[model samples]
Target: MKIGLFGGSFNPVHNGHIKIAEFAYKTLGLDKIYFIPTAISPFKKKNQVAADNDRINMLNLALENFNYNSEVSLFEIKRGGVSYTFETIRYFKKKFPNDELFFIMGSDLLPKFHKWEYVEEMTQSCQFVVYKRSKNINKINAKKYGIKIMNNPIFDESSTKVRQGQLALVDVKVNNYIGNNFLYAKEIIHSLLTAKRAKHCVAAAEFAVLLAKSIKYDAKKAYYAGLFHDICKELDENESRAFISQFVENAYDRKLFPNYKLHQLAGALWFKHIYMNDDEEIYNAIKIHTSLALELSTLDKILYIADKICDGRAFAGVQKLRQLALENFDECFKQVVQRNIDYNLAKNITFSDEQNEINNKWSK
Candidate 1:
């Protein structure tokens, strides 16, 4: 039997992957194709990849929609650590010693083929086939290496495009899954904020979900609130003040209009203004994420605590605060608030009247 091994990050499988699988199945005359998702690609950053289950589930969903004799393989994902092609080929060869195995890839990777670990050994175990990835790629490269290049029709879809909010490039079910679960929250955040800031936002979103789950609050809402809490953090003082002046009714209150706190108000309004999302809970959570309010809601506390204790944040007692958040939320909330207050006092940071009011309330 002839079997094909199609391996990739498949961060969130899209239509392009299904197209390649279908083309390979017919062109290669393979009995079955195994879609192998790498746990960690040596070529890609660790944080850039989606969770293992999410990637696997998306691949399954995409494969289900396409008419093909293919299945997702957890071999590489289960193995963990940086996935090497040679290691994967060796395992598959042993598992199906009598079967002719083909290692499938794209034209784009042809140039880097020589750099892959154990390239010579892998070739001896399995036949290498390259599928044309795009119209712009030259065929000379594949021919020069004497590798079988499949002239599959250009689908011109990529996981990067899909992550950047191009839902149409993916299967319908996969598209719905990404939307419902907020799978590419980092991509969306990264597009707006700096890389460091984007990482923090994504971490906060993840931490918020954990806190929400502990309290039986709405996890999805908490995720959105945390992910976008600092959306306006990079805004200039003038732009931020403009947003606050227009959207905030009490902008005239000089005591509350601290420069540092401008983004909170601006982000809340900008989210509503841009997305037209009238979710008062999410908006309020973003508004008060920097400055805790008296008698906070569950969602509010979750976002605040998440922003303070998320993985990207580095400070004393962060680990303890994270543990306390999972075990005892009220105590964690108080400590986080107190820590913020203490930091402000130590730095001699000017306290806005709003901060003073919140401090007084929390004090009592």
Candidate 2:
């Protein structure tokens, strides 16, 4: 029997991982493939990786989606220590001594391959196969170790990116699992904000998801933007300005806005710098959510309206706006902007020409 060993953090097991496993299984004509999820990677930080059960569950969900001849092995997770490639190869070698063993890895790890624990022993125990992970040049030659480099297309998936709120990169089931379990960065919203504000954030996120589904936009982006839109709202003036000055470029004008409005700018930057999220749409939506930007995207409008009429906020006409948001997005968006303008006018609050223009464009 021919068996393949595909191992990685599999942090959330995105579609890219599944594709690589499928390619290796077919290309090597393996009778079966075992996906080993590491409890602790020697290279990655301990806190950065997801819990073992969560990773295992996501892998199972992703593999089940493909219905391929693959199984997830808990050898590394059960071992309960820093997972080294040599140790895994030794364990598998004992388990499948009579069968041919092939170790599968990504090209990104090629540079540090020789530095791994017992590298010579692992190479001698099993054949090594590498798939393209990116368009980077390898520092070391694969032929030096007799490694078989597959001409597979590069997969742009990264668990780091996925953890930073790029849910679209993962499989549908895996994405759902992450969402349902509140895995990854979703739970961090509470730690960064006050209780009342954190609850409001979750409420806004839920409402944003509804609005996103109504408009057929990406719900994940909308939810994240809404949840973290007020991440910097409670920060003192000094700290807010410090973060803005350091992380937010082109903020000469934003710093002059009232304390109430600074969170939008600060929150966007905090989400990027602290959470390491790089989705421009989510960043823009969170940045302008408090003061709606001109020429709004559907996602932008959804977040604005959701933040205003979420269930946590209590005010006249909120229920009507909420109903309209799910029923007629454009009408609801226009009304929400108009109300914001009216509220500011009643409170004797002066808004900029940009805010006025946004009102005029949408109110018409």
Candidate 3:
């Protein structure tokens, strides 16, 4: 009988992790695989990154989709120290003495064999299986290490790349902590935003999705943020004003708020007021898209730019702004800010602190 030992931080085990185990199952003819997330990695600080519980949660989510490739063992994470692979291998050997052990890893990490404790003895303890990762060719100095390489599981991926992605098909990245934690609103949230605003929201969602895809931000989360950016825009002036009054108290009515900016604040308030769905991410996007939103999220940046450049907005130079959004976000933002500033100046309209704060923030 042969069982595989696949262990790592599993910290948010993503699609890549699942792929490796899946490939290993077929290529190496393994009976079962265990996904062990490190509690305290010897290589790095535990607190400096997501906590074990968070990673565990993402693992739960990954397993929900993968079902077979993921299972949780508190062994190393509960032990709370540097997780040396030798210690894990020894324990698994004791548990399944009759089963053949195949330790799966990438070809690159094989060189650090000497660094692992009792390296000489560990090699004889289990059959090591190295997989070619990335574009790196299958170059296994197996005879020297008394190991073999699995050509089938040679996936071009890593945990680093998974975390950097906005979305993954079958990744361990959706562990218990981040498991389905994305914010969402069901019905009214959609009803509240205007057709024009809804179009912008969808565009912003797509824009944020594209950016997150580029940088590996969470597409699920970014998409929700985009769809809800203007969720309160459809609220009547009185209802919208009432919602804003709770946060921006100055005996301020909706009329006091600027048309260009009232929607942002209103959207944030309405989500909590109506849906009992309070979200900091959604609030941030809604509050910041008007004037010159501050400290923008990937989703916020998309909505802000989309509002300025959406096809429905016939404002001056919108075509150019949309074109610029593809290449230069900052420049596009500056142009929007400058246009608003000039518009206010020409109309002799009074500015609010929100407007002033945004204008100052974007200038930086």
Best by lDDT: 1
For model 3, residues 1-364, the per-residue Cα lDDT tens digits are 6777777776446677777778887788877777788766666553344567777776676767654544567778877778888888888889888889888876767665657787777788888887767556434446677778776645555555434322333342342133244312323234444556667677767765654555566766666666667777666667767677776775254455665667777776654443334466766776767754556666666666656556566766777877776667667767767776777779998777776787777655
The CA lDDT of each predicted structure is 0.83, 0.82, 0.65
lDDT of 2 by residue, 8-63 (tens): 89987887888888888889999999999988888785457778999999898887
TM-scores for the candidates: 0.59, 0.57, 0.52
lDDT of 2: 0.82
- By lDDT, the better pick of 2 and 3 is 2
Prediction 3 global C-alpha lDDT: 0.65
| Of candidates 3 and 2, the better by TM-score | 2
Q: After superposition, how far is residue 191 of candidate 1 from its true place, in Å?
A: 1.9
How much is the lDDT of residue 67 in candidate 1? 72
Poorest 10 consecutive residues by lDDT, candidate 2: 248-257
Model 2 Cα shift for residue 129 (angstroms) = 0.9
lDDT of 1 by residue, 14-59 (tens): 8888888888999989999999999998877545888899998888
Give candidate 2's total backbone clashes.
0
Higher-ranked by TM-score: 1 or 2: 1
